[model samples]
Target chain A: MGQKGSKVQITENDRAILQLKRSRDEIHKFTRRTDLLISSERLKLKEMIKENPTKCKSDPRVRFLLKRIHYQDHLLQQALEQLINLENLVSTLEFKLVETQFIKGLERGNQILKKLNKEFENVDELMDDVQMQIAYQEEVDEVLAHSIVGVNDFETEIDKELDQMEREINPQQQIEMPSVDKLPDLKQRPIASSERKEQGKKEGTEAPVLA
Target chain B: MSNQSELPPIYSFPPLYTRQPNGLIRRQQINSWIEIILQYCISQKCWRMTAEGMPVGEPDVTKQSIFNNSSIQRVVPQVFVDEIWSQMCEEGKALGVQDGKRDSSQFYILWRNLDSWASLILQWFESSGSLNQVITIYELSQGDGTADWEFHGMPEALVAHCLKPLCQRNRATLIKDERGIAVATKVV
Candidate 1:
């Protein structure tokens, strides 16, 4: 069954390429493990020698472990070669896949362009019609502008009246008023005795009424 | 140096050897034991420890084990030891090495959690400009490249465990052998 609605469709070639890459990774892992084992085995040999220098030199286990380490090292080299081959294979397959996809994409794009060109065969004529319509609209807008009354002239008259009022108010405001300036000083002055006498008289008259 | 000089003053307290009858006091006692275990492990750079207080992979740290205070002639009871390990596991300060193993006989001490360890390694990698480089698990812990690093000489297993978070986040990939043992890692 095919994968429906999936953005990336995995073909058999992709799976084969993936398998090659996985095998390459597996080989790399094996070599690394062997390398670590060799180091560990060497360490163990040193420890063994330290524990008993005389007995260790003649120990069969040491010889066996060394042989095993050597064999693993050789296997690692072989695995490395195999890994290189696998990597080359995977890269080649990947390149072929990419090239195929790119060519397919170009074919699809060319087909679409051809369809678009067929659809746009009358584009120049349509553009000419659009230009004529735009010109007609512009002519209509010009006529409408000419037929409208001059509202700007009325706005200018109002602006001129406002400016005249501002000019008149400016001079009036600039004119100094001696009386107004002296009024506050006059108010601060003490009340005259005549005014106090009047105030007392008024209070005396009100007192009799209250009685 | 003598182990007594390295021990905290509370280790000499005889009451620490016995399990407390009171629930509240027992909880405090277990907490103290957990602190001691963590501190002792950190000081000794001990990664694995048995329930009997033997430091695995570190034969030299036998004298520095925290379970016994020879001068005081007291050893923590097995029950209290189990309680301490249980509390430690619950607190995420330690983890059992073997899955589905309930005995807590052997466990790894985590002075810092895996996330912290992962970040620390990432920081080191960034500082050293070793990003996108394939490094062996042993080389990271025991190789000359990491001799000056704080996590130098750490057990490979713990280093692998610490790298799990990075792997899960796709910041690193672990390359394993045919036996499924991770031998090297590539961090980006």
Candidate 2:
């Protein structure tokens, strides 16, 4: 349900209305697919938790292969800006510029705008980054939450795929994840466990927008 | 990295899901909306969306699952229609959205951006070589055998809006139809 409370009446030049309708529609599709992706990612993370019990080392494949390493948010913001800029450009065209040779310039600019618009056509790539981050984070959180019952499955091969996905969001870097059973020996397992729990909570919220 | 504020104002608007207001912009928005569907609807291509929720007054089923009372309490609550409409409207995209319906005059631009569309029309005009020839405004509006070009489905008001510029260069003229519709003749 939308804001049924407000008596706000949406009225404007027909074309502007059309543009809003359109962007929403496209975004709706984007969000819809995003929902499905996030769902599957949730399933994967849940399964990993169920399979692993004690702090045996998470499958490097699982931990390192997570999506959403970094810059994906940048792209979403970019694409969104691109469309908005296009919208503003169009609105300005409607409002200003009466015939001149400049129409040709406008035409050329239109091509650029069109090309930018095209980038939005397939936004699933953006979703992939967001989902990966969430999925990996979920696994991390769940692992920390349960406090080691046994084998945590993290695979390095899957890490390869995740590396590609993460590259789009963040730079590709090889990270070493100790086996679930191999907790870092910096301190006692129990003390380290408590500290990790705190760290996990902090990282959970700070998930960077991959762009 | 783009500042979140630097992005289109559409981002913050909660009611982007609401419908449009009037004129050429509205229809263009609708056509764009139609275009946007090509990406989603992988299953059977759900092209025609009415903005009304799924049949039985439920929100998108997936959204329903995610928004629980705890999450609802944490973040501000937004209903599907209201949120979509409000976001777009607040960001200045919405117009004429009412209780359960959007104004027929209002449309969402989903697919091609309007400026590109203007260029598209201009290109069609150039390619067709009918620039100077008289064209009943109706041909450009939604009618029989139209929609051949992206320009089809354009509102007469929008056609006139575009022509206003063309006419300044003496490249086009907007005369009257017997029925009071605009008849434009763009000179190549």
lDDT for position A27 in model 1:
77
Could you tell me the TM-score of candidate 2?
0.25
Identify the leading candidate in terms of TM-score.
1
Q: Judged by lDDT against the true structure, how good is candidate 1?
A: 0.76
Could you give candidate 1's per-residue lDDT for residues B1-188 as a string of tens digits? 14555557777789988999999999998888887777777777888888777678754566444687777778887777888888888787787777514466788888888789888888888887666555567668865557787787777777888888887777777766578877667677
Off by over 4 Å in 1: A1-211, B63-65, B100-104
Looking at candidate 2 chain A, the ten consecutive residues that score lowest on lDDT are: A1-10
Pairs in steric clash, model 1: none
lDDT of the structure predicted as candidate 2: 0.47
Query: How well is each residue in A1-211 modelled by candidate 1, as lDDT tens digits?
Result: 1323322233456445545555665676688788888899989978877888888768998888888888988998899899779768765776776798899999999999999999999999999999999999999998888756466677789999999999987765556657665464665355676688899999999998999
Clash count per candidate: 0, 93
Candidate 1 total steric clashes: 0
